[model samples]
Target: MIVLGVDPGSRVTGFGLVEKRGNRMACVHAGIIRPEKAACFQEKLHLLFRSLVAIIQEFQPSEMAIEDIFYAKNVKSALKLGHARGALLIAAAHCGVGIFEYTPLEIKKSVVGYGRGTKEQVQYMMKMILGIRGDLHLDATDALAAAVCHLNTASFRAAAHHAGGYAK
Candidate 1:
């Protein structure tokens, strides 16, 4: 299965792609989308939407995993993040990709084995899990973590179903 994960931000949106074969996961691509700094906010959003649409068309992922909104200290910042996320979600929907949302805590726990793991920890574990090499941007790593989390959760659910409906 090919999965695309997105970590949305107003200034820089991160994206990662992974492919799952049997029990192994491989990183296909990872990068960030940065809109022009001088562009208006609405234009930035439009750019985000267009970039994501192109990405979806190019990758043709079977599923898209995104990080859900969390409480933010600043209302304006949170709203901007929501706008970015909305654009990504719309692009995925337009491409007919199955959308999966996960919380930051869930992503961290799935990748790093702790809900409160630091970004460094999550990045390290992502590299270890995906056999990634060299330095990776935090946002891209987080996006990859979201994809890995969804894969793990989906596999667990399937296993439980095969095991005669085991409980969570």
Candidate 2:
């Protein structure tokens, strides 16, 4: 299965496409999406939405795994994040992709074996897991981690569905 993972932000959004290959995983693509600094909030949202729509159309991923909502100390920052996330969600749905949400805790635990793992740890582990080398932006690494988390959790999610359980 191909999973498109997203780490949403107001200034910079990260995205990664991961495909399961037998017992392994490979990164099909990964990068950050950032509108120009001069962009207004609405323009930024529009650009993000259009960019992601193009990405989804190009990659045609089977599923999209995005970070779930979380509390932020700054209200303005949180609101902008929510707006960005909304754009991302609309893009995926528009392209007919199944959407899944994972909490930061779940994503960290799945990727690093620690719910509160540090970002540096998550970055190091992503390289090891994907057998990739070179530095990646924290947002990009987190996006990749979200994809890996989905791959690791897929089996459980499937079993839960069969057992009449639910996923959130």
Candidate 3:
């Protein structure tokens, strides 16, 4: 199964794609969508939409896992993040990909075994799990970690189903 994970941001959106086969998972691609700072806000948004749509078309993922917004002290910042996330969701829906949203706490716990794990901890764990030796952007690594968490949980559920079938 191929899962695309997204960390949406107005200025820079991070994306990671991973494919799971049996018990092994490998990264297909991971990068950030950086909109030109010189461009106007509307132009940046158009670029984001176009870039995300192109990625979706090229990868053809079976599902998309996105981070859900957590409470933020800055309402304005939160609103901007909401807009970016909405754009991503809209693109996924248009591409007919199933969408699953996970909270930051869920993602952290799944990846680091602690809901309040530090950013460095999550990044370290992502590198360890994915066997990625090269440098990685923090946001891009986080997005890949989220995808790995989903893959692990989803595969666990599938294994349980198979075990239950044999038990029956």
Best of the two (2, 3) by lDDT: 2
Measured against the true structure, the TM-scores of the candidates, in listed sequence, are 0.96, 0.93, 0.91
Ranked by TM-score, top first = 1, 2, 3
- lDDT (Cα, tens digit) per residue for candidate 1, span 6-100: 98999998899989999999899998899999999999999989998898889888999999999899999999999999988998998899999
Better of 1 and 2 by TM-score: 1
Q: 87-132, model 2: which lDDT tens digit per residue?
A: 9999999899999999999999999999999989998998999887
Q: Where does candidate 3 stray beyond 4 Å?
A: 163-168
The Cα RMSD of model 3 versus the native structure comes to: 2.8
CA lDDT, candidate 3, residue 109? 95
Q: Local error of candidate 2 at 1, Å?
A: 1.5
All candidates' lDDT scores?
0.91, 0.91, 0.85
Looking at model 2, which ten-residue stretch has the lowest summed lDDT? 151-160
lDDT of 2: 0.91
TM for candidate 3 is: 0.91
Ten-residue region with minimum lDDT total, candidate 3: 159-168
Clashing pairs in 2: none
